[model samples]
Target: VVDFAKFKNLIGAGFINAQRGLDDSTHAEKDILGKILGKLFRSGNTDAAPSEMKESTLALKQVVDGMQKTVDTDFRTGVAKLLPGLKIFGYPGISDSELSTETTLNVGTILESHTRIRYDQGDGLFLPETYNGLGSRNLIYMLFQLYEFFRDWQSRLIENGIYLIFIEEPEAHLHPQMQQVFIKRINEIVDQFSTTLNVGKPWPVQFVITTHSTHIANETEFESIRYFLTEKNQQRTTRIKDLRKEFRASDLEIDKQFLHKYLTLTKCDLFFCDKAVLIEGPTERILMPNLIEKVDKNLTEELKLKGQFISVVEVGGAYMHHFYKFLDFLELRTLVITDLDSTALESGKYPACEVSKGTHT
Candidate 1:
């Protein structure tokens, strides 16, 4: 769980550093905001003052000054009177030296503690983000993180480096439609930011999204998907099957296009499942679950399919062969259920007939 206010404060700190023309390497070592405020009030250095000051910064300075005044009048005076009587191991303490306190404002701390994300309800009323739905919160947080990464790129925090962002299971809280929309729109959002904020140079960022949602996988381009398969060996090593290269190696453009369109339209879960059943029609697909259950009930517990993840696909007899290469590439245990259409040749013409009466199959 990310503290949204703290993330915003970090972004604010980055912006302040950029505004001050401070070197990026020294950001961790220096308190840029504190130094700016010290120059403005304590040193009275007009030349060092920033051209613009935010209202938040002004309020923070006032709070720091009020705290300093309270410490000076109340805490310091009280401690001074008590110092004469204070003794350590029967040795009397001297009260000749006065104790002084210095107060420094930390903008990050103040803003993080005070800031809250609120949604504007009608009539100027606002509701806190905590009141929003979990799905919305998750989506908002993900987008904000992306924005922060984009800002980092725009600020040139790490020059000449590629920003590789790995978004693990972004579809966790999102609905199927929203998951599809997110996969479709994420790259567009990054490209838009790069073009608008980064001038001519593109944001050197690449996204590697890992998702179990069929909606997200369907929405993603075929070339971008990599299927990971765990081998049934002692070590159980994982193998990555790059869809683009696999399809390209076959040199079947029509088959590749057909498979891509078929998966996109059907939103098949074949990619995530352990085993698959390729059926000839809707009837077989509809009855697959019951068929598996019946078979599982009669088999031994170890051999039963009750706990196995199996995906049933209705590809029709004419198109079932098209998926053979894909299923083979995945190394999935597949059961193809297609009708064996028997035919009879008469005068060089083959016509369909019953299996018992037909000569060829």
Candidate 2:
């Protein structure tokens, strides 16, 4: 049921629950709340005896029940609510037919609610194999799978407990438009869950993601970003948030609008790149990634598996100074592969990396 090709991914979940019988075989002392919350979500029964259930399980069951009743009452009205300024489509003879065939996701069964996306074939009914099939659209399939994973993660969020979600390479199969809007949609959903129960206070939910999409990283706030590197067979993370001693105060004053705009214009991959090879043109950008893969398959395979791949950025020779000036705390190994096209070694046109005698950068 990890796949979400169809809205109902639970076709086999009940079978798995029956096979495992996770609760039946365990004792109260064995599956404590600490242990249960620490693990992935397992099926629970609300009808079970009090001694047999954990406090976290009961809370989720109650939350799901309350949300279910609110949605059910809207179904009795027999008409869907239309967004303002949007009118329902009307055909010549089908004006009386309902705007769209109704299909509701089963959040009432302790599942998450989903908005059904449908396309009209010949008949008006929202039939199978309409538009949900991934044969034509690959982006929808990839995002659908990510949502399935997130839905499962949400069940593990015990009330008043810290929860985290991890994702890697969310840009898979996504177009530029989808990539730009991805993090915004996720933030909206997280904000909703936090404020659902208490009006003023929200739940604490955080997540980490590894990606190569500058579009996704550009959408992210500066505070949420962290750089990662592997040095001498040991992995390290760079938290730019508290690196005041190592970085200059001026480095922290980067303009948010300029950052997003410059990255978008230059198509800079610095936002999510693990290691960077800064070049001077499109010729290197198109050829360097494949060239690196061919040079060392082992490094390439590791990067692919861990989602920490290197990025080749094409920064024009003139603008490199501005880039180096702003991102002073770039911890990733950067190789400034610029051309020594100038006769004067002392000319100021090139990037600052050249004038610094290659000591760092």
Candidate 3:
């Protein structure tokens, strides 16, 4: 009679082969053999067809001949090599079912090897979307790598006694708070490294950055500020005229409180004055009034010139526009002649209406 038990053992072995990327579909064929034996081989058949008889004769001969061999030296040793974790039963010892259990352990080994290789290759790296793979990574690693490269470059610059550093778009791709941290991170890293190295001098890296970020702009002082204004015709432009030491102690004190903190009030004054004509500003005030008197020859004379009382305000161009409408409200004859600023005219909202077809100045 055919052995159904031996057929089931082969099927379990085939499964392990497939999982290990080994050749063969022996398991499926063995299962088919088991089903066939269960249905057709209930009774022992002494007489059979020529082909069937021959196959059974050969198989039976092999079994009887194999039984004559020493179980310990031949079959047991060979099986132990093939299936390491094979467990044995009682007197019958090591049935085909027990061999199948041993093969199950081999299948686990195959699966583990494949899984480890996949993990090492970073299976999720090329995936289009995110994955929860244990070996996956994020952009922080790339950022840290880039930071190391730049820190080395900055150190070289410091070694040569380089003082100036300019960076544009330092806030690129970052939120406001992140931009602040970005600056802080650079500052902290450079200072810390430089301190440890004792490079050239203290705080070796000084920076000048151009940024449209309001947070960055707010962090600057007046000396670091530079303002430029262009007017309607685009021909007029001006920059702050320095008069740092020209003013008296009182004027400088006034400017200290006014220039930076009260820029709004100063800008408005420019709009109200008929000719802003920035004189020697804070320090310039000491000699500006006298200079105007000298030029106009009005040492002792007073004339009712309409809008001629030019308020020579001593302030920067930024806050100049602050007082434009305030003076206009007071019905003062004002002209902001300090800079060729078109901020008022650019909006096309000045008080002057477009002249009619027949009108001419």
Candidate 4:
């Protein structure tokens, strides 16, 4: 859930507390923010003054103090009187003598209730996040969350720790170009944090992003991708295919580079498809879907390809062989449709000819 209300706690003591093995319902006295404020106002530090605290912290304290005063004077008096009248049945009358007014400031509550995400619409004009498009809001939310994570890590609340962040389908509300941009820039954001901290090799953060966007996948490095496959068995177990090892052999260097470049350039979504159709050129690429529909019409429902996910790639006959090993690696059922440009050698050159007259194919 992308609830802005919970964002504060997620990025604040709530996250740090969880890392410290503390319960979610931890008292404010034990909270990180509360502890910091308590240290500043302790008996020995009485002369520290509110000026020593951050402006926001002092403001929060003032608001909470005013609310506490109001509750004690107006609300608690009525509750105290009502407590004496509750001497019902055989139970002893409720005692209000020991009751004392206490107020606790919840950072999450303040942020959720008081914070407003406003956008500068124009000169002296502003609009709330609610008025913005969902895509824009989502993008802003994700980037802010990333920054919060970096800040939390930099706080060093937990020593010798690493953050395993799982960003699922970040492309949800993003356009193709935005998705590509996100893929390209996400690492830069993390890298900047690492540089600031002067972190050594294997920085204390790892991101596992699962995306269905071809643009994102295309922008990402081939070695970083992991394809999840569900086995077609009774148990239906899941398997992971590490693309880094797919063509790692020295002999397959050219094939690996070619596959990477081809997929990146074309933005082919073969990684997410159930079936693939490798065609000769633009002609077959354009007509393959309709051709499949026509063929499907003649087949039984069980054998039809009407509802199956299929990807078509325009790999010309001369280059189609490049994907042979790659497609086999994916275990994808594929159909190769190519034109046989039959020719015969006459003198020193091979000329196009009919199949019957062609000496070479």
Q: Please, what are the lDDT tens digits per residue for candidate 3 over residues 270-296?
A: 322345454324656676656666666
Regarding TM-score, does 1 or 4 come out ahead?
Answer: 4
> Model 4 compared with the native: what TM-score?
0.72
In candidate 2, what residue range of length 10 has the lowest lDDT sum?
12-21
How well does model 2 score by local distance difference test? Answer: 0.49
lDDT of 4 by residue, 216-328 (tens): 88777768989888899999998999888987888888888888789878999898899998888998877877888899988998888877888888887888878988887
Report residue 204 deviation for candidate 4 (angstroms): 1.7
In candidate 4, position 201 carries an lDDT of 36
By TM-score rank, best first, the candidates go 4, 1, 2, 3
Model 2, TM vs. native:
0.43
Per residue, candidate 2 scores C-alpha lDDT tens digits across 1-361 of: 5556332322212111111112223322222212223222242332321222346555665675675566567653444554221234544655554443344433232232222344566666664322342322334433443333333433432332444556666666567777777766876766664465234354354666777677787666555666553344445533434223333356535544445566766666775556777788887778776776576666655555235556667777775665564355665577787765533234544334543355323
Estimate, for each residue in 160-212, the C-alpha lDDT of model 1 and write its tens digit: 35667777787766788888888899888988877775665676667777777
Go through the candidates in order and give the C-alpha RMSD of each one to the true structure.
10.4, 19.0, 31.1, 9.3
Best by TM-score: 4
